[model samples]
Target: MPTFTALTTLPGQAAAEAFVEALERLEPEPTGVGIFEIEDGSGFWEVGGYFAEAPDAAALDLLAAAFGARTFVVSEVPETDWVAHVKRELAPVTAGRFFVYGSHDAGRVPEGAVALLIEAAMAFGTGHHGTTKGCLQALDRLVAAGVEARIAADIGCGTAVLAMAAARIWGHPVLASDIDPVAVEVAQANAAANGLADKVICLEAAGFDHPRLREAAPFDLIFANILKGPLVELAPDMAATCATGGHVILSGLLNDQAEAVLTAYDAAGFGLCNRVEIGEWTTLTLLKPHG
Candidate 1:
């Protein structure tokens, strides 16, 4: 069975959503349709669809023209066992004290390292991407500096890897939240796989918008490894929810975007304590002022 995808970018959220609705109505209807903000400080939104059969190019062109969107780029996705491919290609990642690996690499965990079992099929944060690795390394540095977080939260925690790491190191329950329900389920599964199900509590919420997160406010440590735009937008809320003298680790930023994120946190009463760059991504450790 072959799969096809069509992707395009439009200017506004409303327009992008409308475009998705139109996509759902097309002949050879898409198996799935999604829309997401580009998140690079660009005001554009990306709309995409997956199909079991080739989509009609003429209909796509007409929809794009009507919605003032860029022409859709359609491509056939090669049929491959993606899980098997990821298992072969993704070697275990060692970030200081944390070791991230799939079950296939179970034999490779080193002595005394905090082992995190993250299957390739999980949502994200398998520790393969520079962003996730950078964030892990930043957390390692904070522990080395004797930072103690009694209450921690991992916002936008895709697979709850960060939350699990915090739980493993500090022996405390860590709250992990993701906007997607599927990701929350994956996080829970990952936590149970690592035997940290009690320590890493997974929830479905956007940023800090859930009742559980609000009740657990004034967190001692926080992790938000989302994109630059959301990081900036989250600055004020992070400041309000974090205890004075608490710490936040942020990533999912290009090197060029680090300064803007730093400035946003600074204005929110946080001072940069450490910055780490791995490849093109930068991770920041920021502390809320005790004043």
Candidate 2:
């Protein structure tokens, strides 16, 4: 069956969310509605809805005018096997000492490499994106520098790839958490697939709010590959939760936004140790000073 999508952008989060709420209740009834920040520092949010039937264009136009948003661009989405499409589009991605691939490419993993199996899914972090690959490379560099983390956490762990990578290298437990429950579920499934289900624990939490996360506080290493806004907001919590001399590897930032995020972490008591730029994205590795 063919699916239809209607998309538009608005100035603020509240307006975008409200638009989605109204869009869901439209005559045709959307199958799903999604809202996300554009990540361009423009403070604009994108609102989109998927429908089994073509939405009423006039209704969409009225909704856009009411929300002060751009006119909705409606398109028909052709029916395709998305998983097979992903398998064909994504080749194995290798970053430093890590190799990430789907089950179809299992035979291609290089020997002695830390391998992470991530199926193509609705969630993010398959180690194919620059942000995820950069983070993996940073992890490899840390290992090269003789850094061993006994207690580690991966914030916003989408597929739990980073957390599983750390666990495979250090032979220790890793806490992987994401604000989205779907992401947490996907992460857990990926962990089981990688044979690290026992080592990488998955949780649903927003930036270290869980009791388990608090109990695992002062982590020796942490990975937060989320966007700049959340990274800046979580700086204090990251600092407080990170052990002195601990390391934090961060990404999901454009080159221009790295300075502001670094400044926030700097005030929270972290010093940059290394940086990597993959395309427009920059990944940072920082260390909390040891007194």
Candidate 3:
């Protein structure tokens, strides 16, 4: 079976959502439609749809014009078991004291390593990406430096691996949140699979918007492995939510974007304590000034 995907980007969330609604009523009927905000601080939203057959270009064009969006990029996707492909391509990864593996590699966990089970899934952040790996290693280094945190939060936690890692190392409940509900569900499942369900609580939220997050303010440690734009936007909230002398681990940035993110945090009263580069991604460890 041939699968086709049509995607377009527009400036506002309302336009993107309207595009998705229009796509839902298309003649051939799409299999799925999604509207997502672009997280690069572009203030743009993406609308996409999947079809079992090639979508009508004329209809797509009309929809794009109506929504004031760019022309749809339509492409045929080869039929493949993406989950299986990910399992084969993503070998178990070891970063510092953490061992991230799918269930297929359960027996490969090294002795004395904190094991995190994050199966290949639709959600991102499996520790295979440099951003996730760098964050994990940063956590390890923090532990090595004898920094112990009793309260921790993982904002934008994709698979909740960082939250699970903190739970495993510190034996405390770590708040994990993501804007996507699917990712939050995946994080919850991953935490349960790793036997940290009791210690790693997952929620659907954007940054620190939830009531639970507000009540759990002043975290001793915080992890925000998101893009530079959001990282910069989050600086003030991070500063307010982090305890005095607390630590924060951040990633999901290109090498060139690190300084801007660091500067943003610096303005929010955080000093860089350490930086780890993995491939093109840079993870930063920062400390809030002690009162």
For candidate 2, write residues 1-291 as lDDT tens digits.
899999999999888888889988998999999999998869999999999999999999999999999999999999999888998899999999999998888999999988889987532688888999999999999999999999999999999999999999999999999999998999899999989999999999999999999999889999999999899999999999999999999999999999999999999999999999999999999999997
Candidate 3 residue lDDT tens string, 1-291: 999999989998777777788889997899999888886779899899999999999999998898799999999999898899998899998999899998888999999999988887632688889999999999999999999989999999988999999999999899999999988988889888889989999999999999999999899999999888799999999999999999999999999889999889999999999998899899999999886
Say which prediction, candidate 2 or candidate 3, comes out ahead on TM-score. 2
Q: What do the candidate models score in CA lDDT, each in turn?
A: 0.93, 0.94, 0.91
Reference-based TM-score of each model: 0.96, 0.96, 0.89
Higher-scoring candidate on TM-score, 1 or 3: 1
* Candidate 3 whole-model C-alpha lDDT, 0 to 1: 0.91
Off by over 4 Å in 3: 9-21, 34-46, 66-70
Error of 3 at 150 (Å): 0.5
Clashes of each: 0, 0, 0
User: Model 1 TM-score?
Assistant: 0.96
> Quick one: how many clashes does candidate 2 have?
0
> What does the lDDT read for residue 98 in candidate 1?
93
Which pairs clash inside model 3?
A: none
